[model samples]
Target chain A: MLNFDSQGLMPAVIVDDETGTVLLVAFMNQEAYQLTRESGQTHFFSRSRNRIWHKGEQSGNVQDVRDMFVNCEENSLLIRVKQHGDAACHEGYQSCYYRRLLPDESYEIVAERIFDPEDVYGTE
Target chain B: MLNFDSQGLMPAVIVDDETGTVLLVAFMNQEAYQLTRESGQTHFFSRSRNRIWHKGEQSGNVQDVRDMFVNCEENSLLIRVKQHGDAACHEGYQSCYYRRLLPDESYEIVAERIFDPEDVYGTE
Candidate 1:
């Protein structure tokens, strides 16, 4: 049996197949996980929204599944995918990680925005 | 304002600083984040138990904070750390990622067990 957490959720790591940089993290339930494997697309179960949502449903930044990895306990998953848009982050960055925390205990912006959030999400 | 999800949690990605390999994924609350930064260690908020937990408290495989990264929207965090001990996975592996999914839909074990989980967690 696949080990789902007490919440019936398993965390998924979305990463760029070529670059190996993580795009973001999301959660999946059994249904979402099965659908993802069958459809070869990325899908997440929104605990807050109480629904399964496609990755590119809003921003057209879909992730085409390349491969998957699981932890030994089968409780966590790593998804390697071919990212389809100029950005994966809702904030218009290629990767969600755009800022780095410095050794001085401050933060630094490390990545450039690949797309304009206002243009994609349309002013919100 | 930091975007805590509707569930009042933010997802965190843990990565090995030297190797750049993602170790695992966890979640944090504002309090957990503050403690992590202040203590230079990894802390997580367990949604299931509704408690704050130190990563290495039990396994002694603690993560020493090296740096941190925040996504553009401040919704997600990437933790760079120096992992202590031989393994970070409760399954006695170096990382939580140990199995790779093949194109044929079968899973392959890609990582070796660095330590004996039976010796640590005790025979289940």
Candidate 2:
């Protein structure tokens, strides 16, 4: 029942299966979704790069698919996954959600970086 | 630093502030983002409706935003909110993600419906 928008993509929410933390939000095209369904791992469409990327393909911090859910309208997808390696974020944080916005319109760093992106991507 | 895509929108991940359960995924436009920041409540641009909506405005199941987070690329938003009523899904489930996908390629109902959608939307 899932439907893509005019851009041929839908939003996917990645959550930590054990901790319930929202790891990140990504997008998926039909191809990415099909591969993810078949492989039981996260795959995404990069909006900027205009290509499909297997999660952690370069950094090796993969997200192991645990379960998937779709909204009642089938407009969005939610996937609970076990994060492999130290982080799910390229910035080396366990989650892409590291900064918390305050009421004063400023931000506070709420999470610690688990790996250094420079260390992971530089050598790649 | 948030940037909308070519469609002038970005993905918003809605999560339970305390439980961290992903409740739903929505889209936000510039106007919606501004109103959300001003009101501390969830506002979304309905792509299908072609307008802005204050969540729970119709069903009385509002989402009181607790915090906001932006990704490293500032392309997506993570919103942690407290749901006011029993449901966030129009289907009357506490979470839009009530069905879990099994390896067999079938869906299993994993969460209980907290309210009846017909009741809430009726007599409106």
Best by lDDT: 2
lDDT of all predictions, in order shown? 0.85, 0.87
Q: What DockQ does candidate 2 have relative to the true complex?
A: 0.79
> Candidate 2 residues A1-124, lDDT tens each?
6788888898899988888888889999999999998888999999889999999999877888988898887768899898998588898888887887677767788898888788889955
- Give the lDDT of residue B63 in candidate 1: 96
RMSD of 1: 2.9
For A35-72, candidate 1 gives per-residue lDDT tens digits of: 89889999999876899989989988999999889876
Model 1: per-residue Cα lDDT at residue A86:
57
Candidate 2 C-alpha error for residue A109, in Å: 1.4
True contacts kept of each: 0.85, 0.82
lDDT of 2 at A91: 86
Q: What TM-score, computed on C-alpha atoms, does each candidate reach? A: 0.84, 0.95
TM-score of the B chain in model 1?
0.92
Off by over 4 Å in 1: A5-7, A47-50, A101-107, B47-51, B101-106, B121-124
